[model samples]
Target: MHQEPDFLHNLHQELRDGRRWLDRSIVLAYAAAAGLCVVAFTLMADAGFELFQRIYRWQGGWAVLLWLPAITVAAVWATRRWAPGAAGSGIPQVMVTLDPAVSEHQRSRFVSLWLSFSKMALASAGFAAGLSIGREGPSVQVAAGVMHSARRWLGPHSGISSHALLVAGGAAGIAAAFNAPLAGVVFAIEELSRKLESRSSGLIIAAIVLAGLMGVSAFGNLSYFGRIRVPSLTWNALLPGLCVALASGVLGGLFAKVMAASLTSPAERMNRWRARFPLRFAAGGALVIAVIGLVTGGATFGAGSEAVKHMLAGEADVPSFYVTLKFVATWLSAWVGVPGGIFAPSLSIGAGVGHNVATLTGSDSIAPALIAMGMAAFLAAVTQAPLTAFIIVMEMVDGHAMVLSLMASAMLASLISRMLARPLYETLAHHMASALPGPASTQDPPEPAHAPGVPQQK
Candidate 1:
């Protein structure tokens, strides 16, 4: 009898351990799935942009005039009708889910699989229409949704909570989207979770690694903007860095402020008009973008990545007005309530600003360094997340030599941005939380499947 009881206990213990490993394995599997999704989305976005370029080359201005408005209407309408949570850059949506005030029900809706599907499909549609948007931001939500879906498969004894899944998914998204694993980890700490829990550290890093591995497998070992060769920066480059930081800070701050105002403040006339007739408003915004594109010879169109790459390669000289028009185009693209992101567009605008600063300073010799700084500074100012911005820019161009400069520019620009507006993602997350149907709750939300685990703080 004693031997039988011991044998049963041993078997039970082994089975329990097996179950735990299996549950953890599910998390890893889902993370890899999220990475695959991001890689696919990247391919889809590039294909969509190629299609738009073909149309633009054939009919030029005429094609854009009719094409942009029609696609804008379709994207906006589809988002509103099907997946309302898939609107905007999607970063705010993921951020809102992290708020403690939001109920599990609300959080689930925000990051559902349907929303992820719609986000990718509709965002790709916007790309085809030549919208000035990026995929990195939306990738966060998409990956989060994919990861969150794993909650259904996890057992009650599973150690990883739903919150951890969401955070891991988001980090994985960034890692895969940009092929920047460290930047993704920084983004999770600085922007997504606001604090990296000891318990979640391994999971987050693993997710980023898996996601990055997926990207590397598909694209090979290439940086997002390719390796930009930068020489040693002497004291002379500092002045240009400062100037680029100032311009990016002001412009990025204003962009963030206006975007938040449009979302949270219904009193704004444009918001009111948009609320009444969203289609008309989107069409109007499309018209404005079309006119800007026509005047800029299509430089202001798309996400502005190709233009930035060409500039970095010394193959193209963008018009001096590129920054102003691209900024307006990006702003309008966001305001029109499409499923898109400002991340790439913000980088593009920053590149333009840096180029102009280089031109003005006659620092043609160090233009590449300044361009990289501008990209980091403007992104930092817009998002108000200096570390993430710096690391992202550093990784994108393999700017290991310019680490100190990139960090300083990002920090200064973020500080300057604070004077003009609140943190862009935080402000938008608050608005999104407030717009949810139920009153804010003070009590902690029950975990998915009612299993207890550490919850992320807002």
Candidate 2:
């Protein structure tokens, strides 16, 4: 073969190198765009809740009771009519899209810009409706959708898999939403991917950093739940910590069990009824949630993030049955076919459990510590992703001093949760995967069978 000149070879090599850089730049752009989307999402969610609060303050309980059902009816109707895939905690949808068996055409319906936008808007409506739902889970889908949108721009030759995009976007969502970069990374590894590929490590970190920077710029560098001054763990504190952990484990497990049962009810008739009369069903569920809110003096409404903050600050005076009532409220909200998440509500419920445990044990001095532990343990139990749960709680509370205890509590609670319910998100993902059209659905590897019904578009 004739030898090419060195200059020609160098020129070709430079072109190749330039293309690689361009591809990387595109990915960075996607990451940055995802972060911007999350920031907008956070603002929208907060604004919705603020509007609801204003309405409540203006007209009192009657207005709230009416607002919830009416908005929920609208939200549920809009969800079913337009973006059915946007319903519920969107984590499961993202999880399903990651399945290699799911074709790109199929995955588009699950993770696309339109679906993500609808999810954000509808979830904000849920917040305005005083639904006991969170934005964190929806954030994952939104960011994933934004990140995944680059597929057409960067062809298959770009060496970036859809898997990497989805994972990065989802992780970025967590980082931005909670302002916890490390927790975001751990969540990607522990919950989203189960195992992070070495090739994706740089991408994941870059996404998290970009998203987290956006969060910091918009919200300030503060803990998600505000920091607490926890005393060093001592033998005297062990008993209280353990009690909180046990309580969180059982309660969280119960919540998981009930959730699984509600979603995967063996009663096909009920599912049919719900499908046929989605508006009526949503209205009914909304009515129950409104009643729960009234009974709890509105403590159980709107994801309970504020309530958890109040408890941590020792400024809350929750009802004795707050935990159970909030649990019912969150579950009903999810059942109402609205677009929202359980993450914040779950943390609130955990805080209530911790409060009750501290009160029962007369450990007021260490209540904050117990509350932190409960948040971690219960989340761990519910998700069965102990590392992610613990890291989230740790970051939210700035609880470095309580690291060991939080880890222990999360591990124990996750173990106990397994005894009562299978991994909640994975099981739900399995249900969703099984519902996809085509033979690939049948080829999904075995996963936990005990899952609830997924939000399917009619």
Candidate 1 lDDT for residue 79: 91
Name the runs in model 2 displaced over 4 angstroms: 1-16, 266-269, 448-458
Worst 10 residues of 1 by lDDT: 445-454
Predicted candidate 2 versus true structure: per-residue lDDT over 403-448, tens digit per residue: 9888999888888887888778877777777777895479654454
lDDT of 1 by residue, 334-438 (tens): 989898999999999999988999889998888888899999999998998888899999999999988988998888888788889877777777777777788
State the lDDT at 70 in candidate 2. Answer: 96
Candidate achieving the largest lDDT: 1
Q: Each candidate's TM vs. the true structure?
A: 0.92, 0.93
Residue pairs clashing, model 2: 263-452, 263-453, 264-452
Clashes of 2: 3
